[model samples]
Target: MDSFTLNKAAGAVLMVLILTMGVGIVSDIIFEPTIPGEPGYEIVLATPEDSTSEVEPEPDVVPIGERLMAASASAGENVAKKCAACHSFDQGGGNKVGPALWNVMGRKPGGLDGFGYSSAMTAYGEEKPEWTYEGMDNFLAAPKQYISGTSMGFAGLRRPEERADMIAYLRELSENPMPLPGQ
Candidate 1:
C-alpha cells in the first residue's frame, strides 16, 4: 500500500531467496557427492568367441529330400501364403510383383517372358538349367544368398521343413508335379 510497506515486502522476498540460495550452497558443501571413476556396473560386451560359446550348436538339419518325404501340401499352402503378396500360385495366374509361380518347381529360374527377370536370376538360370529339389531348397532358404543379386525380396523360409513343404506345394502347382526326390 505505502512505499515503505512495499519496500519491506520486496526486501522480505529478496531475503527469502538469499536464504534459500545460502541453504542450498551449505547443504551441497556438507553432502558432497562422490562420482566413481567407473560406472556402478560395468557392461561387458560378448566377443565373437564368447558369443559362440554361449550359443548352443545348431541342431542337426534333416536333408531337404528327407523332409520332403513327409512334407504336407496343406501345411505348405499356409507357408505359401507369405509368397502370395509377391507371386501368384494358381495355374494360369498372371505375374504379380514377382512372376506367377505356377509350375515353378521344374521350370528354369527367370524363365517367365512377360515378367522382367533380374540379370542375376537369368544368369542363375543359365548356370542351373532347372530348379532341382536341392537347388529349390537352398534358394528358398536364402534367395539373395543363393543367387547373390536376385531381385526376389523374400527373406526366405528358415526351417528345412517349411522349405520342403513349400517345394512340395510348388511341385503340385504343375500339371505333372516332378516326382519327389529319391522316389
Candidate 2:
C-alpha cells in the first residue's frame, strides 16, 4: 500500500481505539464511585444456617469403612437404581455411559478396555493402584471431588448409610466380595 493510504488506515485505527478507551473511561466513572463501597449495586450475603427449608445435613465423622460393616445390600439396591442409568451391575454387562461396574471392587480405576475414561481417572488408577472399600467409599461419597475432571458426573452419595448400602450392593456385584473393612 502507498504511504498516504497506510497513514489514513493507521489514523482510522487510532481513532477507533481512542473512542473505545473513552467509552470505557466514561463507563467506569459512571458505574464506580470515587470512594470505595459505593458501587452501583450492593451485595447481600446469606448468613450461615439462614437458608429456608434446610435439606439433610451431612452425617457424622465416622469412617466410611466402618460404616460399610453396617451397610445393607437391600438398601443399596434402591440406591443402585440411580446408578443403573449409567452402569450395569451384572457380570459381562457391557459399558454404558460409565464402564460396567461388575467386580469393580479391587479393580483398577478406569480398567475397562474400549470404554473411554477421563485422563484424571486414568491417572488416579496409576496413583492409587487398586480400589479398597475405603477408597471406593470416599470416591462414592464424592466422585468429582475425589477425582476431579473424571467422566463420572454423579454428585455422590451424601448419607453414610446410603453410601454404605451402595457399597454393599456393589460388593455383591462381584463373584468374590472383598473382605469388609475391619473384618
Candidate 3:
C-alpha cells in the first residue's frame, strides 16, 4: 500500500525474472552442440580380409518341437497372461479382442465362428490347413511378419521356449489334447 513497499516488491519480482533468464541463457550456451556436423566420435567397424566370403548367421534357438519336448505347461500358463487380455483359454470361453483360443492348436486360423478376423489371417488359414506345431511356432514368433496385414497387435513371443510352452498350454486347453511333437 505504501510507495516504498510497492517499489521493493516490484524490484524483487524484476530481479527474480532476470535471474531465471540468466540461468536459461547460461545453460543454453553450455549445452548447445558446438559443431553442427561433427559427431565428436568415430565408429570403426572391422571387415574380413577376404571380401568374397559369404557369412551365414548361426541359429541361436533350436526347433520348436525340440523346445516343446521340454516345455513346461506351468510356465506356459504364466506366458498366457500376455494373451489373456485378448483371448480366452477356457473351453466355451467367449471371444475378446481376438477369438477364444480354446482348442486352437489344430483349428484353422481365423476359424472361430463368432469372432471376426482380418482378411490377411483368413487368407493365411486358406493356405495353411491347420495350426500345426511349426505353423504355431512361426506365427507365435511374429504374427504380423508371419501373416502380413494381420490385425493382431501382439509383438509375438521372442523366446523359442516360451512359444513351445504356450503351444503346450494351448494344446491342453482342448477337450482332446493334440499329440505332442514326439508323442
Cα TM-score per model = 0.67, 0.67, 0.68
lDDT tens digits, residues 18-89, model 1? 999999999999999989998788888755354321112126878777888899988999999999998999
Q: Which stretches of candidate 1 lie over 4 Å from their true place?
A: 1-59
Question: What is the TM-score of candidate 1?
Answer: 0.67
Measured on C-alpha atoms, candidate 2 has an lDDT of 0.82
Q: Alpha carbon lDDT of residue 101, candidate 1?
A: 91
User: How would you encode candidate 3's per-residue C-alpha lDDT over 26-64 as one tens digit per residue?
Assistant: 999999957758666888754434332122212887877
Model 1 RMSD in Å is 8.0
Q: Determine which window of 10 residues in candidate 2 has minimal summed lDDT.
A: 48-57
The C-alpha stretches of model 3 lying farther than 4 A from their native spots are 1-58
Query: Candidate 2's residue-wise lDDT over 111-173, tens digit each?
Result: 778799999889888887788777777788788767766888899987778988988888898
